[model samples]
Target: MIKLLVVDDSPLMRRLLTEIFSAAGDFEVAVARTGAEALDLLTAFAPDVVTLDIHMPGMDGLACLDQIMLIRPCPVVMVSSLTAEGADETLEAMALGAVDFIAKPRGAVSLEIDALAPELVDKVRQAASARISRATRLRERVRARTGGAMARPVPRPRAAQRISVPRGPLPADGLVLVGCSTGGPPALDALLGRLAADFPWPIVVAQHMPASFTGPLARRLDRLCALGVSEVVKATPLHPGQVYIARGDADILITRRAGLLTAIAAPSDPELYWHPSVDRLVSSAMAQVAPESLVGVLMTGMGADGARAMTELRTRGGHTIAESVDTAVVWGMPGALVAADGASVVAPLDRIAGELMALFKA
Candidate 1:
């Protein structure tokens, strides 16, 4: 069974979450009334995942997350009201290594808390064994923070120094490939929004999200970017001016036949380490796209899925990029790529959009 910890200030909420998660026999739920109490239980219990409330009475969710990273690192899901401030905090939480966020229900039904029981339980079960690494979260907590507008991209100096762009322009046919998870939804939306209607070539992305989430995410990004963004339908023909997201329970793969690139949605077996394994996508990409035709971009999330594949891509003479740490909601994915020297250009989020545009044109 996967052990879970629910941390919230309200006694009722703690109980509510517990009752919801308890229905899943696979999850063993534990409750912490506050961050302080949660920390104590975490050291003792070593739970698999944590669902946190952003606005707690004493320490607040962000402060608690910082402390939790230092004391004990675990997959965290932030639960907050769907207000502007809540949105801002959720983003901040992601930047600090929180895996994902959920908007608290706001209705008479929500007063029962149990009204959200079914969805809450499903999320908890799916998040079982979130692959967060202790060292990564520790690093985020140690970093200093400066306030800024919510939309402004955070700078990552370390990653900038880590990358070395090529001396001249890249190949004209380079296709940009990106992969992300955890806090990728809003970030991906922001990323796709900056592109022009004529982005020159195809943009493909693989995000580790459930089936229910991907379609909504695609629609959201579709509304945000000039480029068409939609959920991947199996055997769909790859096209430019359009982007596709890999649905849950499968890691998307690209196949080439007669010079036609196609998207293949392969069913995921839990036996594999990660559900939407970065290795699956990256390795498949390395094989499908010729060395002269592809550029890989690795972004934020936990685990080392893209690490080896990024190295392989670079070894195959393909250009590669890693999202700088500061801009990442969680630095694991990009951090792994950087550590292995897989990135051709390490850039902040804001610069990545502009850089990608220029790359496709070259």
Candidate 2:
């Protein structure tokens, strides 16, 4: 049976988590009331996975996470409250290497609570089954084996930046806007590594994931990309020379307030399939930046979130690019753009950044 560990300060919460996992029938559960208890438990148990609460007395979740990663490393799923502060701390845990998180319900026995049980169990199972990113683990292992500065790996060709277009030159102020899902990690890394460090415009991205995952995902991208990268905060303005990735599960829309651009995470009624909707951002950005906006590229994703926006932008005199089907993990988004006449250019991932730069020059 798979061994599972749960750490939470509340007795009721610990019991509830145990009961939920018990019904899954594939694992054994162990409980800890604090980080100290959790560490003691860990000394005696090699758990396959852990569910750690974000709030704990004496030793909070993040400190516990750092110790766990540094010592007996295992995949951890953070349990967090619904408040914004909870969201931020949950994000911190992910950046410190926690796998994923679940927001607690208002009432313990509420309908929402019951609904989350299956998802929690499944996440635990998946976390147990999956391997950590090879690149991340490789760096860690290098740091472990030798007390030396580990060199970052050399990236593949222009997978991140190559662009195709009917083109004049690219615009100088057209910062990159990237959208991806599923196989985004490695693909984005490859493409980002090829981008010029001084690419003029600030990059804005919308990737499908939960809010907690974005911060860590951005840090991972920062490690791989030459440009400065960080998770987008609510109302953070677009600035040249920095790349901002939208915090996930929110519809990322760009709005211009008195001539300045802000990345707005707005609530939506599920008109689109992907959280952090590319359509919302692209469509809204057109109005925000207007005629000055030169290019929008739709990368790998499962659905057509960006197609309508691409169409709107193309109709209004902006260039659009899509990733080629051959290299796309799931060509649905880019393919929709290609099929919809939204894309002015379609090429492999390698050429997009250069293509964008060319459009800027024109």
TM-score, candidate 2, is 0.58
In terms of TM-score, which candidate is strongest?
Answer: 1
TM-score attained by model 1:
0.63
Q: Write one digit per residue (lDDT tens) for candidate 1, span 1-362.
A: 88898998877777767767777667888888888888899879898889999998988899988887777777788897756566556656865767786557777534756666765665555455455657545544443253222343343343344355453556555466788876676567557767777776677788876555566667656755679987776777777778877876677887876778877788885666565667777778777667657878888666667778877888778777787775676677888998898887888765677667666545
**What is the TM-score of each predicted model, taking all chains together?**
0.63, 0.58
Model 1 CA deviation exceeding 4 Å by range: 1-159, 165-168, 269-271
State the displacement of the C-alpha of residue 101, model 2, in Å, after optimal TM-score superposition: 12
Show model 2 residue runs off by greater than 4 Å: 1-165
> lDDT of candidate 1 vs native?
0.72
lDDT of 2 by residue, 177-285 (tens): 6777644544565566567787778888888777766776677668656788888767887788777888877887777766777777777537676778887778778
